[model samples]
Target: MKKLSSKIWSLIILFLVITVVFMSLFTNFLYDQLYVKDSEESMIEVGERLQSNYQGGKVTDEFVEKVEDFNMYSTFNVFAVRNPKELSACVPFEIDYDTLIGPEERRQLLKGEPITKIGYEERFEREVISVIVPLTDQNRLEGIIYLYYPLARITELANNEVIILISSVVVFSMLLAFFVHKGLGHIMRPLNELQHAVEKMSDGDYKTRVNVSSKDEIGKLSEAFNEMAAAIQSEDEDKKTFLATVSHELRTPISYVKGYSEAIQNNFIEGKEKDDAIQLIHREANRMERLTNELLQLAHSNRDQEKIDVYPMVISETIRESVDLLKNQSKHKEVEINLELDDSLIVQANEEKLKQIFINVIENSIRYSNKKSLIYILLKASGGNAVIEINDQGIGIPKDDLPYITEPFYRVNKARSRADGGSGLGLSIVKDLVKQHNGKLLIDSELGKGTYVTITIPLMEEL
Candidate 1:
C-alpha cells in the first residue's frame, strides 16, 4: 500500500502535469488564431497608410521604395495592385496577388467589405494572414493595396510566449505543491498522533494526549479526541477502583458466611452459642445478597429501562406506600415524617419500577436522616411533571459529591454507609428507574445542612 503522503503528492503532481499539457495544447490552438487576427488588423492599418501615398492608382518609385522600407521595418510581406490587371510586389514570394487574393475577396472589396483572410501557400511552406484595400484618389477607387503577414514569425513569437507561460506555470505549481505538502503535513500530524493514541487506548493505556496547535477543523478534532481519551481514562480508573471495593466487600462477607456455616456444621457450638452462629451466618448471607442484588441492578438497569412498561399511576399513592414501609425504620432513627402530596400527581410510569424508585430514595433518606430530624416527602404536579422530592435533615452529602452521587457504587461517606449496611446503589437505582419513566433526577445538598433528591416524571394527561 502507498503511504498517505506519497499518494497525495502523486495525485497532486498528476493533476498539475495534466494541466500543463492541456494548457500547452490549448494555448497552441488559440495563439495561432489570435496571431492571424492581429496580423490582419495590422495589415489594414498599413493599407490605409498606403492609400494616402498613392496618386490616381499610380505609385511613384519613391512611394514603392517607402513601401519596401515599411515592410523591412515591420513584419509584413507586401504587394501592390493597380486594378485587377496590374500587379506589383515589394518582396519575393511565389504566389501573385491575382492567385493569392481570390475573386470572392475582390468582389467583397469592391462592395466595401474589408479584405482579410488566413491562408497557407504550398510554395512558401508557410501560412499567411492578409488584408487588402482599394487605393483611393480623392475618394475614387483607383488601384488596390495588398499586404500579407507570414505566420512563421507569429509562430516563433507564440512559441516564445508559450515557453514563458509554461515556465511560470511550472514555477507556480512547484511552489503550490510545496505549500500543499506542508499544509497536509500540518493537518496529518494530529491524525498521526491520534492513531497512536487510539492504538495505545486499545492496548488498555488510556492516558493518551495529543498536541493541538491550530484553530482549524483538524485541531478541533484533536481536542475532541483528547477529551474522549480523558473520559475513557477516568472510567477505567473508576472501574478498577470499583472492582477492588467489590472484592473487599464480597470476600469479607463470604468468609464470614463460610466460616460460620462450617463451625455450625462441625457442631462447634450449642444452645445460645449455636443460635448466635446461625444468626451470624444469616447476617453475612444477607450482606452477600444485598451486594449481589446491587450488582445485578447495575448490570440490568439499561435492559430494564428498555423493557419498561409505562402507564399512568398515582405518584402520591406510591410515595405514601414508600413512607409507610420506611415508617418503622425512620421511627428507630427518631426521625419525624412530614408528607405533602397532591392526589392528582399522576405520572406515566411502570408501577413496580416506580414503587422501587420511591423505595430506594426514601430508604436512602431514612438511612441518612439525623435522629428526631424531619424527613419531608413532597409530591406535586408541577409543569406537567410529577415532581417528587425527598428531603432529609441529616449529615448532608458534600457539595463536591453531589454530581457523582447517583453513579453506581459511589458513596459519600463509605464508613457510615458500611456501618448502616447501605449498598451504595440506592440513588443509582433511583436515577435509572426515573430515566426509565422519562424522568429527571436532581440531588441538591450542602454539607451539614441537608440533602434533597428531586424526581420529575412526566405527568399523564388527566382525561
Candidate 2:
C-alpha cells in the first residue's frame, strides 16, 4: 500500500548509506597502509642500529652514555636498560613488568630476535608503535634498547584527510536527497494527472483529459489518454443518437397501422376502402421488417473483423453479380448500369461481405439518379489492390455532409424523408464491411454532380 515516492526514496537513502560506509573503510585502510606501516619500519631500523653499537661486552656505563646522546637528536623516545625490569624507566608512568617483557619475550631476546609492539599503551596513555632490540654477550642478555613513536603523530596527515572526507560525504548526501526529491516530483506529476483522468472516466466522465506539455514518455502517455477520452465521448453521443433515430423512424408506421386496423375492426369502411387499408398495413409491415433486417446486419458488421473468413477471390465477378441482382430496381427508374471491368483482378476478401458492399453503393447510386440516367461501374487493378469505382449521374451530397455520410442514421437532406431516401444505415454498413475486408472506401462528390465511391481491396499476393 506504500506510495511510489516512498519506495524510490528508500532506495536512494540505502544507496547513500552504503557509499558513505565504503568511503570510511577505504580511508582507514589507506591510513594503515601508507603511514602506520612506514612508521613501524623506521622505528625497527633505529632500534637495530643502536643494538649494533653495543660492542659485544659486559654491560657498561659508557655504552649507556652513548645511547643517551643518540636520543636527543632522534624523533623517537630511545632508552637503554641494564636488566629487562629497568625498561619501565623510559616513560613517566609505571607499566606492568610482565606485560612489557614476559618469560617468552626474554627467551626470544636472548636468542637475538627483536620484538615489535603496536597498540594502545596504558602507561604512555596513547596508542603507540614500538620496537625492542636486545644487547647480548656470550649467549646471555646484557641489556636492551627501546624505541617508540605515538601512533597519532605518525598518522596525523591521513587523519586530517579522513575528517574532511566524512564532512564532505555528509553534506553531499543531504544535497543529493533534496534534488532527487524534487526531480521525482517533476517526473511523477504527469503520471498522477493521467491517473486522476482515468478515475474520472471510470466514474462516467468520458470528457476528461490531461494536459500534454513535453515530448517525453509521460507527454506521449497524456496524448494517448486524451485520444481515448475523445473516442469514448464520440461513441456515447452516437449511441444516444442511434436510439433516438430508431424511435422516430418506427413511430409513424406504428401509428398508421394502428389507426387503420382500429377503423377496420369497427367496420368503419367496406369493400375497396377496407382492401386499400389492408394493403397499406402490408406495405408498412414490409418497411418495418426491412428496417429490422438492415439494423441486424449493421450490428453484425461491428463485430471483430478477425472472425470474418477471407480468401483469394475474383472481385470483378462479385461486382458483376451485384449489378445483375440490382438490375430490376435500376430498371424501374429507367437507369442503365454501364460496366467496364478487368476480369483478371483478384482480391483477398470474404465473398459475401464484398458482395454486400457493392450492392449498397450501387443501389444508392440508382436511388438518387435522374430518370433514364447512366450509372458507371469500373473495376481495375490499382497499386496492390483491386479497385472498384462506382459513379452515378445522381443528386450528389453537399461538401459539408460528405465527411459524415457513413455515420448511422445520417441523411444529407432530411426533407427527402425515409420513404424516398431508404434507411440511412446503408452507407454505414458499407463502411463497416469494407473495413472488415481490410479495404479503403473513399467518396468524392459535389452537389448535383453525383457521388463517386471508390473501393480498394488488397490483391492476392501471388497474383
Candidate 3:
C-alpha cells in the first residue's frame, strides 16, 4: 500500500531543491559583492588622478575640468569635499551632502582615510552607494573625493541573473522528475508482475508466472515465484491423477459387490454358481475394505504424528513373523523369500508399524514379482545400526520411476499396478511407517533387473 516510488522521488527533489536554492542565493550574494567591488575600484582610479593632479591636495580649475570630463566619460556621480561636513568643489547636488553621507563615513575620510560604503537613504528617497577617497599631501588631510555609483544598476543585473538561474533550475527539475519517474517505473515493473502473479496464484491459477530477464533482486524474486507456481502446478496435477485412480479403484470393487449381491437376490445363478458369485462378492468387498483401511492409515498418520508407541524390539523376530504371515500368499505366487537375519538386530520402533512396514513391502514384492522368483530378506547389525535389505526379482520398476515410486498413488505401470490390485499406496505406507521409527528408507531399481529396498534404523540396546 505504501508508495516506494513517491518516497524516493520526494527525497530526490528535496535534495535538488536544497542544493539549487543554496547555490542561487550564494551566487547572487557573491555577484552583488563582486559587482560593487569593481565599481569601487573604478572610482578609486579616478579619485587618485584627481588627487595627484591637484596643487596642495586641492582641486584647481584644470582638476575641475578633468573631473567634469571624467564624469562625462565614465559612469559615476563625482564630487569633492573640503571638510568632513561640506562639499567644496562640485557638481549640482541633488541630495544634500550632509544628509547623504553618514557622520562616521565623513569623519573617516576627513581624517585622510579613504572608505567605501553601501547604504539606503530614505532622506533622499533612494538607495545610495559611494566611495570616498581622501586627498593627502605629505600625510596631511586637505580634501576628499566622493564617487557615487547607482545601486539600482547592481540590483537590476542581479535580478536578471536570478531570473536566468531560476529558469535553468526549473528546466533541470523537470528533466530530473521525468527521468526519475521512468527509472523507478522500470525498476518496479518486475515487482508489479510478481504482485500480479501472486494474486493469480491466490485465485488458484497455479500456471501464473512473471517474465523477467535482469539478474537483479527482482529477477531472483521472479524466479522464485515461477518455482513456487511450478510446485503447486505439479501437486495439483498429482491430486487429479490420484482422484481418478482412487475413483476407478473404488468403483470396480463396488460394481462387483453390487452386481453379485443383486444376482444372489434375484436367483440369477444356480447353487454352485451362486456360491462362486458370493465368493467373488466377498473378495471384492475385502479389496474395498483393504483400500479403505490403507486410506485410513494415511489419514491417521497425518492426524497423529506422535501417536506411535515406540519400544526396543528385536527386528529379526519381527521380520520372521512378517514372513510367516505372508507365507501362504508367497506360496500362491510361487515366490521364494530367502531370509538372512542377525539375531542381535534390535531397534527402537513401534512394533505394529514395523510389522506393517514389512508386510506392505513383502506383499508388493509378491504381487509385482514374477512367479518362482527369489526375494532376498536380509537383516544385520552394522555400524551401530540395524539394517534391513529386501531385494526382489519383481518385474522391476523403471529406472526413471525409482524416485517417485514411493509417492501415494504413483505407479510405474498403471495398468499392471491396477491388475495386481495395487492402490499404489503400499510403498508409500511402508516409507511412512519406517520414517515413524526414525529409520531411513532407500529404494534402487532398474527396469527388468529387480528392486532393492534398504531400511536403516539406529540399534537400541536390550534395555
TM-score of each: 0.70, 0.82, 0.66
Q: Of the candidates numbered 2 and 3, which has the greater TM-score value?
A: 2
Per-residue lDDT of candidate 2, residues 319-435 (tens digit): 889999998999898999999999998788888989999999999999999899999999988888888999999999999999999988889889884668477999999999999
**Could you say which candidate leads in TM-score?**
2
Ranking by lDDT: 2, 3, 1
The whole-model lDDT of each prediction reads 0.78, 0.86, 0.80
Q: Which candidate is the best by lDDT?
A: 2
Instruction: Write the candidate numbers in order of decreasing TM-score.
Output: 2, 1, 3
The list of candidate 2 runs beyond 4 A from truth reads 97-99, 102-112, 123-125, 136-140, 153-184, 242-292, 382-384, 461-463
Q: How far is candidate 2 from the true structure (C-alpha RMSD, Å)?
A: 3.8
lDDT of 1 at 177: 73
Number of backbone collisions per candidate:
1, 0, 0
Kindly list the per-residue Cα lDDT of model 1 for residues 1-463, writing each as its tens digit. 6668788889887997898799778877777667666667778887888766766646566665676677677777666655545544343445466665577866666664567767776756887777777765555555666677667653466577788986898899788878998988976788888888889889988988999987888799989998999999898998898898789888877898888888889888789988988888888889889889878887788567678768877778877887888888988999888998999667778777788888888788777778889988888777888888889888888778888888877888877777688877778888887887788999898777788888898988767
Residue-level lDDT tens digits of model 3 in 231-289: 99998998888788789889988998998899899889888999999988888888888
RMSD values, in order shown: 5.8, 3.8, 6.3
Poorest 10 consecutive residues by lDDT, candidate 2 = 151-160
